[model samples]
Target: MSQHHISEVPVEQREIGMLAKHREHIIDQIDELVKRTKYLELLNECQRHGLLSPGMCQNIKEYTPGRRNENEEDLLLERHRQLFKKLTQRGPRAYETIISVLESLDCKEAANVLLSVDSGSFVSLREANKSRRPGMTVVDEGVTTEGLVLSKVSKESKYQYLNPNEPLVPYTKPVQNSKRIVKKSDKCHEDAVTGTYPMCSQYNRGVLFMVNIIDFPNPGVIRNGAFKDGEELIHLFREIGFTIFPYINLNKEQYMRILKELTSSQYVENTECFVMVLMTHGNRVNQIDRAEFHDGSIAMVQTEIIAHFQASNCRKLANKPKILMFPFCRGPEPDKGVETDGRSAASPKPTAQPKRNIPTLSDSLVCYASTEGFETLRDPDTGSWYIQKFCDVMAEYAHNTSFEDILKKTQSLVQNMRTATGHLQTGNYKNIGFNKKLYFNPGFYK
Candidate 1:
């Protein structure tokens, strides 16, 4: 009972302390393993019920308590089956309890403590969580009762807010290509008895006409410069199949008579598609010439031209495309004025008015030389900028693309050329209402 016996007692006490610590560690490990097993089982039950995503199954498999050994896997499977059956009977409350326990431990601490017992299952669990629930909120991961409640509540609330009587604001007008004015007229005379005129039948082929009135004297003269490019334009269209009609030297009466004759019972009766190319000087609303004045003047043609064509007698051209190419300077006044602070305060002025005098063709295309009110430029050598581009593009792409495509390409090319090369710009004012595509291919192959 001397020094040896005393050292033996201390050693025994140390061994007891070590055993107690190891037992506590084992208890903690068992608790986490049991919690994870329940979580996996609950998730599997949810999958069977179609409540859980496929991702949950993979996550649970990784966290399951097991090894490659048959006995351990069997034990893990039994635990999973038991827990799943319990969850199916008791519902999500059992799973919620397990999640609450897991949340109490720091995620990294829990992984470290759990990893040593069965590395394979723990690794799988970690991988599943990393893939499916990385940075996911409780609500997004659907791991808690509160999260599930929120998901259901949100869906129900959305259904309650469904509305049927909301007012609709159209993003764009439906009657884009059809002239609103024409539709108004048709609506006005819906019940009227009208005789139909077959203009194309009376005429052998479609009538293509161009009216250019360049040299007008005095206040009667709407455009100031010399005949810029009207003749050039006429020639371009002529090459494309237009029957050139020079109205440049005609007096007021003569011009009116020619238009009337064209719109008369005999001429319009047989015309298939009517094209009028007008090149003249124009203000915002009127086309001016020597000695005579016409209001609502579009080029040299009066507004009545469209109204005349819409007449019941001119049914042959009904729904047929009517193409009008007008190259003229339009608007009230040029945008020029004084500056302030010794700096030019002027912004680039608008090129033209938004309104164009284009007829609705459902069968038609109206290519304006400039935007609404901007002055169209004419090269003393080449003619009007827009007319030149229009003629060029139409001649080139008429057979290759649809009329709409041609117009779009023409608009883009003309705008680019004008902005790059000239101060004045041109644009096509398109309002298409054609039932069928117009193929201007007569001169393409020739």
Candidate 2:
């Protein structure tokens, strides 16, 4: 390990080459450098010096929260690791630029932290041939008959889906070498940026409670392609690290029970976010926002649905993102097609701190497939335009963009969408209690 010291490194390899080899050491010292430096300011200084590329900046920004875990001690270690990895991939002057940037930012300790790494040392490798676990395979449709006694019907059933809450091989000890290897670990800002909520991938990512209503008793229209929407949604959110619990054709009692279970579940307690997606027929009755259940009973969106995750009722989800998506009608009318006079489409992003004393419903977002008084259009073969777009945008941009911005993009796509009759359907949302930004950080930990 002593042979890898920075003092013994060749001058030519000092900053650039040694960076790649010594990255683990750099990560090892993360707790130190971050203890003395302002991480974002470091990024800014690096960018200002033309040392960090825009893509790198966006990647780091998206991976690390803008606000959460910002304290000196609890600093995000991966942020520095990512920056170092990018720097190593850079050209000749990468070393001088970062060192200068560190000095300019009054982060001499951070600079020294880099310069002090023992580059000659290499971490021990994990056993290349460890016993394989019985892993369950995930498919696009989400329903799998593989991996267990029940799966004897198919070759895919040889393994079982591992529950994360359950300990994996209880006798196996976790590998704990900070100076082992450079671990692997997105974009920002055409729109206004806000403070990002901390999304920890160390444990649970988030919980998704989805109810897809395709069947209703009596004269109600059986929502065609609704299951497609639900299937797509389940697939999409699982990528976001959500523990998906999906229900189909639930009556009012069962729907209410789902809500009750979610609110009272231990999963929400440690989750970074809680999302509820409802695909069913809905309409405004006496100015109340309501949607139909399997039995055709109406659910009060605000009181019954949103109220469940409010800080007052579910304290466990307090200060966390509670995203409620209603891909259904809110009123009886459709948004008539509007002729835009012209087609078109930058500001320096502003970073704002989340204000205190917000509201009982803080940290929640409500997404409506169509604006009030408009009918949400759905395709018999596909699904609703709003939800399909929502899935698409999130899949493409959630890595580097804020959830709010993703929603905005989804809405923008929905606004121009015309039904078969040439009527416009616009997606809208209520941004309640969101003073900060939210990044999905898809597949970061995995």
Candidate 3:
């Protein structure tokens, strides 16, 4: 009977009711909770669930004006007290959010303390939130079994918040360069007829060139958990019948030299599609991005990377899909997003087809971590939200979905996410001159 303890209030209202009924007891336990809490990890979990309001997380991280001189641990405990109090005010949904976070973080003792705040039977945090999502068996507050499977079951970025004053490079019209060379898509028509970018198993070895920068010169700039993203990318892309060419921390000059090698006759002639992923800290001055490297923390301009693949430079890959995914900050502004419902959006109309008069940068899709002028978020534990979602979406959908649709799904998933303090981020893409239904028919060739 005790195990089956039931509440009189409606399911949606039970957690709130329980929380209110035990408010003081829960409040009393704050000291204990603070003592055991892993504050930063808890902060991330709260952000992941959007439990805290905009800027609340930041407020908790720093001391109020006069208290900066206090002992660090003492200040952190006080901060935890403030966070719990705020969550209590935010009502039961926030209560459920924190409880779930606690459980996921394996702080069971802390979790149970909140669950039984009144020293009486309390509503299960899992039971409280399950009514909202029918198919889900609420294991954690906001996370579902399905989510864990979708997230870990699939496996996936690393970055810091460095938003530069950058604009999304929209490809509205073909560049009018008289000196541009014309590479005909004549040879790519057969591949297009099949409806996906032709991916030959023979060319799988050169399929993706992942330049992951883990070791930065300065200790402050080193991306800690980003290596996880690289590992996942290799496994996921390789499963898609694409070969993975992973390059670790390289000097600034080595970046182009490697790309130049891949553009060698062996790769150039058999290449089906070109995929390049640049994971690093980006500093923007004007439209150019300074991608970091090891030896000197060398800076490389964003465009040169693209120019290296231009029809003029990499002739064979000009007509194929040239995908460049940058999981780094593009601007200095953090996106404090608006509240909105999830709705189906028609795939963003493709960039108007560039007149193939001379192989004008067609078929190039540049995916940025966030929208123009906004900072993107990254979890020091998992990876960049944008890259993680992108890989996850692809891992699930690439078999039959078009390239454009995949990007939209990735964008939607990334956009709906808000940070612990409620900052929003959006991933976006630019379609270069190439306009055709691109697919990576995983296992079809294998």
Measured over all alpha carbons after superposition, the RMSD of each candidate to the real structure, in angstroms, is 35.4, 27.3, 15.6
lDDT of 3 at 284: 47
TM-score of 1: 0.41
Please write out the lDDT profile of model 2 over residues 1-446, one tens digit for every residue. Answer: 12211111111111112234344555566567666777677876665454442323554665544566477544456676556554543322344445556777877777777666643322211210122122211111111111011111222112222222332211111212112121112322223555677764646888888777665442214454566676677677765667877666677777776577666678777888888888777765445677777665766888888787767778888888888888777654546566677864444675655556746787888988877755566653456677877877776667666788788888877776553334556788887867788877776753
- Superior by TM-score: candidate 1 or candidate 2: 2
Q: How many backbone clashes does candidate 2 have?
A: 12
Position 8, candidate 1: lDDT: 12
- After best superposition, candidate 1 residue 314: deviation in angstroms? 3.3
lDDT per residue as tens, model 1, 1-446 = 22211011110000001122222444545555445444554454444332332322333353345445557657666555534332222112223322333434334454455345444422232332243321111111112211121121211111111011222111111211211110001111111232211221212334555554443322112222223344444444444444444444344455455655564535445555567666554434323211122221222333544444453634566665577666654532222223458665676754533325443334556666666645454432334456655555555554334556666666666555421112334566555444355544433221
* Over 4 Å off, model 2: 1-193, 340-358
Which candidate would rank higher by lDDT, 1 or 2? 2
> In candidate 1, how many Å is residue 249 off?
3.3
Give the whole-model CA lDDT for all candidates, comma-separated: 0.39, 0.58, 0.57
